[model samples]
Target: MTSVVTAGGVSVTMRGPVVDEAEAVLDRLVTDGVPASLMAKNAQLWGPEAVEEASRRLGWLDLPETSRPLLPELAALVERVRADGLDRVVLAGMGGSSLAPEVITRTAGAELTVLDTTDPQQVASVVADRLERTVVVVSSKSGGTIETDSHRRVFEQAFRDAGITGEDLARRFVVVTDPGSPLEKTAREAGYTVVLADPDVGGRYSALTAFGLVPSALAGVDVARLLDEAAALVPALHQPYDNPGLALGAALGASALGGRDKLVIADHGSGITGFGDWAEQLIAESTGKEGKGILPVVVEGPDAPGFAEAEDVRRVLLGARPEDSGLGVSGPLGAQFLLWEYATAVAGRVLGINPFDQPNVQESKDNTAALLRGAAEGEAPTVVAGEPALVVGAVEVHAPAELLRGATDLTGVLEAVVAAIPEHGYLAVMAYLDRFADAGAERLRPLLAQATERLRKTPAAVTFGWGPRFLHSTGQYHKGGPRNGVFLQITGESAQDVPVPGKPYTLRSLQLAQAFGDLRALRSRGRPAVRLHLRDRAAGVEQLLSALA
Candidate 1:
C-alpha cells in the first residue's frame, strides 16, 4: 500500500507495512503534541530537571528564533564577499560541520568546494589553482577538530606561499566555531573573521545554526527564504496527525522495530541529491545506539537496479515535483533539513534513546589519537597484511575466508558472504581508499544486491562508506549500536604521499593508521569484519567487479 501527504511545501509518499505501523503512534503523538512540547523554550521532554536541564542543549528546536536576528549579519557577509570579488569558498571541517555546507554548495550551484578528507590528494585538489581568490571557512564546533586544524594550517601556508601574509592573510580566511572554543581565540588572535556558533547546539543538529548558515550564505543561497520555509513547517509539526515531522518519525521508528531497519532514500531529481549524506549522519548517530539502530541506505535514484528484491529495506522517494499517483511538493532545500531534524528527534523519543548525545563517537577518536602517539613515541602500530590471496582471472585478491567460504575468487566470496548474512542483516563496504578512485568499494553494490536476492531469497541493504570520514559519522553506531552489519573493509596502497604539517608521518600514513585503528576498534567490539587489500585502487576495483560479474 502507498499514500502521499503534502505539508509545509514538502510532499512525502509512504510505502510498505511500516506506514501502517506508524499511523497508530502518529495518532497518539498528534493528540498529545509531544513533539511540539519539546520545541517550547526551556521545556522538559525527557524528565523533571534531570535530563530536562540537559535538554537545554536542544537549542536546535528554536533555531528560527535564534537565527532570525542574525539575518542582517549573514546578508552583510554575503554583500562583503561580493564587493571584495572573492570567487570561491573553501570549507574545511568534518562530519556535521562539512556535510551541510557540502550539500548546500552542490545543490545551490555555489562556487564552494568542501575539503573534508585528510587525503593529501583531496587537499591538494582544492588549492591547486584558486588560493588567491578563495575565502577559506574553517568550521568546527569544538574548535579543536584535528582535521579542521590540519586543514587550516595547510591552507594558511598555501596563502603564505601565494604571498598573502599577516593581516592580509586573515582577509582570506573565516572561522566558524562555538563562542569560546580554542578556534575562536585562535581566529581572533590571527585577525580572521569569526562567526560564533551556538554553544548549546550539538554539531549534528546544528544545521540551522551559524555552522550551516555561514556557508549557505557564501554559496549564494537565499538564507532568509530558506529559514522562512522551514519555519512554516513548525506549525504543521505541532498539529500531530497532519504533522509531517511526526509522520516521518513514526514511520522510521516503527519500520525499524518491524525488522525493516534499512531506510533507503531514492531521490527522483537532483534537488535532493546531496541530502542523503547529511541525513545519514543524523539518523545513524541519533537513533543508532545501545545495541540498536536504523541504517540509512542512500541509492542513486529510484531506478537504481539490484534492490528490487530487498526485504529488510524501506524505500523513500524524494521528488522535487509531485507524482501523478503519489505525493509531491515544492519547498526550499532548507525545509528538508528542518523536517529531518524534527523527525529524528521524534524517532529518538520513539526508540527510547538520547538523540542529542553520541557517547561512542569518542572511542574511535581516542584510538586514532593513541595510534598517532604510538608512532610519535617510536612504537609504530603493526600493519596487518591479508594473506593467501585468491586468484581471480589473472588478479590475486586478499579476502577473509569467513567472507568467502568455499570460494576461489572475489565473486564467489561475495556470494558466500551474502548467503551467510543472517536474515534482516546488512552488508557494509568500508572503503579506506581515496574518494577520487573509481574502482573503490561502491562498485560492489550491484553484486551484493544480486547475491542477496539470489542466495538469501530476501532483500538486504548495502552501504558504502569512506574510512576516517565515516569514523566521525556512522562509525559510532557501527561499534556501539546494533550487531546487524557484516563489514567488508577495503584498503589499497597509496601511489604517492604528502606529509602532515608538523608530524613525522605523511597524510597517507595518517590515513592508514586511522584505517588500521578503526579495524582494531571494530574487532575489539567483536564486530564481524574482514579486510580486502587490493593491488592499488584501480586494480582492486577492477578485480572485484570482474569477480562479482
Candidate 2:
C-alpha cells in the first residue's frame, strides 16, 4: 500500500485490492521508467494507431509552464470585460471545452454559466437573462462543434439585437479555439478577442490550457495560482514509488483489469464542486473505447447508486481533505486536473488503450450531422426511431413491443428495462431536458439502480448523463467500451424553439436530432436502449417520479 502527495497538496492513496493491484503496476512502471518516458513525450507509449494520435496530443504535459505567457493578456481581457459591465460569463462549449471550465469556476467559487446543452429553454433562459451584462466565451477545440457554433451564432445575434452593434457586439464574445481554426479566422474578421489553444492538446486533456483557463479567469478565478499548483506536482511525478500519478493510474488500470471496470466517483463534501463531472469526461472519453475501457460513474455521494459493495465496482471518495485510504483524493483543483490527466495516461499503458483518442465519440456526431442535414434540406426529421409503445401520463415510453408486451403502467415498462441488464451490466439514464428545469430527473439514477439491485438480485451501476453532453463523454463507453449497458433516454419537447441564427435547424430540432441520433447508433450496435419522451416537461418529471416511486 502507498500514499503519495505532491508539494501542491494533491494526494492519492492505494486502498485494499487497489493497493495490491497498484503495487504490481508500479513495480513494472518503476522498472521501465515509464513516468520519465511519458514526461519526455514518448508517443510510442500506446502502440498501434494510438501511437500516431498520442504523438500529436502530448502538449498538455507542459501546459503548466507553457501557458504562463497567457496570464497577463487574460488578466487584461477579463478586466476589460468587467469594465464593460459584463460580470456574467456564459461558456459555450461541449465536452472538455464546457466541463473543464464549469468545474474550474465552481471550485474557485466563481459563477460561470455553462451552455453545453442544446435544450431550447436552457439556451433561452440564459439569453433572456441580463444580455447587457453577459459576455459569452465560445470554446471549441475543433472550432466547428455544432453546439458551440449554435451558441456562438445565437449570442452574436442576441448582442446585435440588444443594440450593442459594431465593435461592441464583437467584444461581447470571447473566442477560444485552436490556431487557424474557422472560429479564429471569424473572430479576427469580426474583431472579437480570440485565444488559440495548443493544437497538440486533446480537448479532454486541456484543463490547464485556454479552454479551461479563459472562462475561469473571466469569472474572477486566480488563474496563475492554478498553474502554480500544477507546476509543483511536476517534480513529484518523475519519482518511482513516490509518484501520485502512477499510484492513481495503477489503481484505475488494475481495478479494470480485475473486472472492476465501473469507476464510481462521489464527492463527500469535497468542496470541489462538480469535479466528478469533469473527471467523468476525461476518464470516459480517454479510455472508453477499443471495447476495453473504464466506466466512470459520477454518483452523488457515498450513498448514491452503484456505491454499494460489488465486485465490478470500485468506489472513490473525494473529500474536503485527501485521505490515505487510496479510495479517496483531495487537493487543489489545478493539481487534481494534472494528477488525473497523468494517471489516465498511465492507466492507458496499464490497459493497453490510447488515452488520447476518442474514436467512438465521432460516430454519434456524424449521425447527428446526417440527421440535421436532412432537416436542413427539407426532409421531415424524425426525432425518435419510431412511435412510442405506450404513452403513460405526459411521458411516451419508446421501446420494442416485446419489452413493453404485457406492460400497462410506467413502472412495469421501467421494470422491463431494469430486468434487461446482465449480471454486471449498467443502466445509463440519459435525459435530454433542461438540466435546470428538469433537475428532478437526477433521482432516477439511484432509483433505477436500487430497483435493479432489488429485482435483479445483482448490484448494477446506473449513471445519469445529461443528453448530448453524455454524447461526448460516456456516450463513447456506451457505443464502444461495453455492450452490457442498458440505456434509458428521456427527451422533452421544448415549449418554444430557439433558432441558431443562420443555421437551418432550431435548437429544439438539434436537441432531438442529437437524442435520436445517439439512440439509433446504440441500437445499431444491438444495445438495449429505450427512450421516454416527455411531452410536458414539468408534468412528465412528476409523473415519471411517481411511476418510479
Candidate 3:
C-alpha cells in the first residue's frame, strides 16, 4: 500500500498505477490552491457555475468545530431517553440523512434501528419491535422526504396505539431537520425534541452536522470524539500536498478520468461497519450527474464477488490499512467522513461538475409522488406498460417485449440484461423488498455480477441497493450517470401491507410506486431495464439463485 497521508490516526493510501496517474492532476490541483480554497469554502473553486449552490452547501467544512456544542445536548437527550426506559433508537430517515448515522451507530455497536425504506415488511419489522422502549429520530434535510414522513406517521401511530399520548408520545420522537423546515415546525408544535441542522449544509455532506451526530450520540457513540477526530484532519486539509483529502480526491478524479468509473469498495476489516453504504450515497449522488460520474460498487468484502479486476474498475479498501491494491481510506469514522466530503468537493472541481446539487434525485421522488396522488384518486399506477414478459417459478419478470428479445424465462431475462451491458458497463440490481425479511436478496448482487463476467468473459460490475433507499443514492447515478448500465429491479409482495397512518397509500404501495417509478425513469431513457416482481420472496430468491447458478 502506498501511504499518501496520515492524520488523526487515519491513513490515506492506494496501490497500483491509479494514484501514479493522478499525480499530475494532484499537482495541478495543488498549484491552483484547490485544497486551501476548499477549506476556506471559496465556493468558486468548483467554477463560477457552482458558486451559487456551493456557497450554501459548504457548512460541513466547519462542522468539526462548529458542531461541538451539540454534544452536551445530544448526551442530555440520550440520558433522558434511557432514564425514561426507552433504550431503542430507530431513525426514520432516507439517504444522506440516514446513511451516516446508520454507519456510526453500527460501528459503535449501538442498537440504532434505521428506517430508510418504504418496504412494508421492513416497516413492519421495526414496528413489531417493542414500541415502549423506542424513541424514533425523524430526520430530513428538506423536511419533505416522503419515506421519513411516512415513518414518523407510522411510529407516532404505533406509540399512540400503545396508549402513549401528548407529551409522552412527543417524547418518543426526536426530530433532526433544517431550521424553519416544515418538519421542524410540526415537530415543535407536536412537542417533539427538535434539533436543527446547519441550513447551509446539504444532506450528503451533513455527516458531521446534526443530521449524523444527534442520532449517533443518542445511540451511545461518542459524538465529541467524532468531532475531535475530524478536527485533527483539519490542519492537513488546508495544505495542498500530503493531504488525506487530496490523496483521496486524486484517486477518485484520476480513476474517473482514466475511464475507471466503477469504484469497487470493500471493507477488509475497516472496524467500521457499513461505511461503504454511507460512502455509496456520498460519492454516487455527488458525482453521478451531468452524464459523467463515478459509480461506487460497494462489495461485502475482499472475498465478495465483483472484486475481480476490471479495466473500468478501481478497488478501494476501507479497512485498518491497505491490505490490497486500491485507494485505501482508513481512519476513525469521523475523520474519514470529513476526508471524503472534502475529496468529493475537490473532485467535483476536477470533473467540472457541481458536487452539491442533486438534479436527478428529485425526479424519482416526483414520480413516486405523482403515483401516490393517482393512488389516492383511485387511479391505477401505470408504472408498467403491460403484463410480464415471462414468469419463472414465483418471480415475474417485466420488460418491453422488444427488449426481452423473445426471452422465455428468468434465465433469459438475466441473459438479456447481461447482453445489454456495453464494454465497461454495469448491471444494477435494485431490491424493493424488506431489507429485514428479504435480507438474503443482497446476495444476488455478487451472484449476478460474477455471472455476467463469466457469461461474457469480460469484467463487469453489479451494484445492489434496497429500493427507495437507493432512490436517494445510486438511483441518481442510474438515471443521470453513464447510460452504459442495465437495471434489474426486484420487488416483493408484502403478505401484510403496512399502512402509512393517515396517508392515503400503504407502505407496500409506496414501495411499488418507487420501484416502478424508477423503472419508468430508466426505460424512458431507453435504458435496457426490467422489473422482477416476486410473488413469493423466499421462493423467488431461491429460484433466482438457481437460475443464476
Q: Model 1, 313-401: lDDT tens per residue?
A: 66665764323322223356778888888888877777777777788878777877888787777765544444545755434445556
Indicate the residue-level lDDT of 285 in model 2: 84
lDDT digits (tens) for residues 1-549 of candidate 3 = 265677667788877687687888899998998887787889888878888999999989999999988888887898899898988889999988899999898898988899998888778889988888998999999998888999999888888888999888989999999988999999999999999899999988988999999888888888898899999989999887778898889879988998989999999777899999999999999999989899999998887889866889888888655555677778888899998998888788888889999888777778788888989998766444367778888988888777787888877878878878889899998988888778888888888887886788786999999988998899888888988988888878778888888888998778878887888788778888888889899999888888788
For candidate 1, the 10 contiguous residues with the lowest summed lDDT are 321-330
Candidate 3 regions exceeding 4 Å error are 1-3, 320-325, 382-385
Q: List the residue pairs that clash in candidate 3.
A: none
The segments of candidate 1 whose C-alpha lies over 4 angstroms from its true place after superposition are 1-4, 41-54, 320-330, 379-403, 437-441
TM-scores for candidates 1 onward, in order = 0.91, 0.97, 0.97
Output the lDDT of residue 317, model 1. 59
What does candidate 2's lDDT look like per residue over 168-277, in tens digits? 89889899999989889888999999998999999999999999999999999998998998998888887775778888888899889889999889898777899999
Query: What CA root-mean-square deviation does each model show from the true structure?
Result: 2.9, 1.6, 1.4
**CA shift at 448, candidate 2, in angstroms?**
1.0
* Poorly placed runs, candidate 2 (over 4 Å): 1-7, 320-326
lDDT (CA) per prediction: 0.74, 0.86, 0.86
Candidates arranged by lDDT, highest first: 2, 3, 1
